[model samples]
Target chain A: MTETLSIETWRLAASYLFLVLLMIMSQLLKLGHGKEFLMATVRMTLQLVLAGYVLELVFSQQHLLVTLAIMLFMQIFALITIFGRVKGKIGIGLKKVVALALFVGTSIPLAYFMIVVISAEPFYAPRYFIPIAGMTVGNSMTGITLGAERLARVFQTNRARIEEALMLGATPQEAVREFLSDTFSAAIIPTINAMLGMGIIFIPGMMSGQILAGASPLDAIKYQIVIMMGILGSVVFAVYLIIQLGYRTFFNERAQLLGNED
Target chain B: MQNAFSLRNVTYRTILSIPSLDVATGSVFGITGKSGSGKTTLLKLLNNLITSDTGTVNYFGTDVLKIDPVTLRRKVMMVPQAPYIFPGTILENIQLIFNFNRKELPVQVEIESLLELFDMPGMLNKKTANMSGGEKQRLALARVLLLDPETLLLDEPTAALDDENARAVFEYLAWWVGKSGKAVVMISHSEALISEFGGSILALSGGQINSFNEEGSVHD
Candidate 1:
């Protein structure tokens, strides 16, 4: 039974293999070096195999502290990724603050919904908390990165337009409102598309996993709905926070535009 | 009319330090320089795109830096050098700057008048991406002009045009200058064109306004 490749595992493995192969193929074509591809394949196999074992331990132990620790680490990693991607300087140290904001902003409501709202057992179950947190933080990370980057780029490129808007008697919000609108909508489209495709074109990994573990279709569907809502919430919160913070950072209290200083 | 745009010691860095210039009310001020001389940067500063590090930009009596951005944009609109024809029809691109319906807000008159201004009345509903360089420049100018800005900051408004099209654009701008009495600041390297228009010329070099010629000289 364990050796057999079920529909779920087969789909998962094939998708992962396809991505790894594509990356390898692109690199190979560029450098004519098969060594990197070989190394990457080996690394993927080992990492996934080890991660599977670690997940088994995590699932069995279900210790709240360990789960919380893992969640925090993922959040920190995501924050750093966002900082590097948006601000273009990894050492800017904005990640810690952003991490705190993301955690407090996303996790508390997620925890409440998972615990008090859904009433899932052990409250901090790695199976529930870790994956859900991962989904939420992952989406928020993308939104914040996109928002920050868009804000910086628009400000840099469209200075005349922005300033012209300002001089035309638009408030800071009024001046940048259209640009922000386009950017925010762009940042949220992925999450929106995921929601649109949920269970129709693609069965999410979590839902499929629950089904594989013997949960009924209805039960899996319920979890999927809850998680999807959480992801949407996270995206919305992140976008709002980043825009608010970005506006404050981009302009002064007297409505003067600020330069992109290090 | 009041002096609509003013800059006091307006120093900015974009590859070099840009010098300050004051534009009088109701006149065309031409920003002339060779390539890479920061004409675009000065336009951006006057338009309030980038804040000066150590000076104040005043619009009328109010400090432009302190003014709201949206208000600033409405007052001083810039038609960029390379027109960004957005992903729609010519009408849609113009409609992007406002919140009202295209049909409700004198779309045909605005479109017709602008097209008539540029003498391209037949190209109203055309897709902007497929349009040629001269067409795009005309469309971009039309869109900005529809906003009715007090200060028009045009970057290479005729760079892409042929002799005829360039002449048409200049004629349209000259007519508008005569009618509205709004400040028109343009960046042009064309000496012959500057001589023809005969506006005050501000020469930019190493980011500074090196010379100001009110008589519109052939050489800086």
Candidate 2:
């Protein structure tokens, strides 16, 4: 395998020229986002540099406990981001349900991919585990957030039909089944579209990263395929779990459709 | 006869507060009040759609909270003011009850008779999306009638219909209660219709009972 060329610190600092050009272009166009763009660039650089150092420490330590702790931290961060993305006030009970769904949905496939699919040495190796977990959990976080928001919105809008069904002796499950299915479909469509456009429309970031790291194209393609499949599985599972459980929150113990007070 | 619904000191969200009320079987109970006087909220309470913040609501002496909501709703159905029309043909909407309960569909002859009774014979095959407001109201009534609940809590069932159609709906409902001996608690703004059909009336003002009348005789 050919060794990948490394960029020196001075040469790497040259990448800031692109941001300067972007700021200048924003100014020329009167877009008024020049300050925001500069701030974002600074934030991104700082965050990535901090992440690099933290990852280096975690990678060198290579302890199972450290790896699991990082995974837990990522899951918590993902859950918070998801809660932030969802519109309207979601109950703490519902938030717990979503967190649990996200956890189980991400962990199961992650374990399967690491243990059975790739069979990585020291199964909890930070290098393999962190990236795989990140990809799956990150994708599924977006999926569940979209699903929860859509479910809440649709349930509120179509409340009359749902209540009509309930009055006709339909259980809460039977009443909202169609809406739940629609939410799942909406949540997964983006991921499905991304999969469809892979390789032809654009090479995925993971695959490009693998190729840049001096791995053979075929080897990179194999890893990409497995990770993508893992991501798809995790997203579908998370969205399904969230919708199935989340829908019940919209009804009461007496099977009546609860109003969307929030 | 045992009252179909009984409430005592029932309160909800400061918009509804009933000290005591009873609706008996084989009787037409009329509810009258201005908009937002909790007219609809009273009907919702009968079916356990919304529980009271305080006090008790009972269906036939049994606490509504204790009964299985699905079973209670099947027995005591509420037809809202602006009823929802499911996406489908009129026939499908009418037949939705059977589908929901996993029962055999009603016979064609029975459906035809019901359609004829509701003055909707021409709408059996028409899509519900194509129905007018009044037609949707009738369709909603037809759909609920298919379930054959013992007590119907109707909120402005004829609000969208013309006088002729409204009278026709009331006439059918009068016949329905007489024949089946089922109870009805109806909220309406038409004082004439209420006086004509209501066996008893409960007038509300700002969520509190203003007066109780039997056979159109006001008694505070």
Candidate with maximal DockQ: 2
TM-score of chain A of each: 0.78, 0.95
Please compute DockQ, using alpha carbons, for every candidate against the native two-chain complex: 0.18, 0.55
Task: List candidate 1 segments past 4 Å from native.
Answer: A1-70, A77-101, A121-221, A228-262, B14-20, B100-104, B215-220
For residue A162, model 2's alpha carbon misses the true position, in angstroms, by 2.9
Model 2, position A117: C-alpha lDDT score? 90
Tens digit of lDDT per residue, candidate 1, span A1-262? 1333356776767767765676778786775656666688779889879978988889999788899898889888887788766565322333443555577767766777778756768888787787788888898888777766676777778876665445434567766787888878887888999999988999999989887777888988988899888888888877777666665566765565775331
Residue-wise lDDT of candidate 2 within B1-220, one digit each (tens)?
6688889999998788998888878767888998878888888888887788899998888999999988888888778888888888988877777777676777877877877777788667899898899988888887777767788888889999999888888887887887888998889887678678756888889989888787657545
Model 1 interface CAPRI class: incorrect
Error of 2 at B191 (Å): 2.9
Each model's TM-score, in the order given? 0.69, 0.94
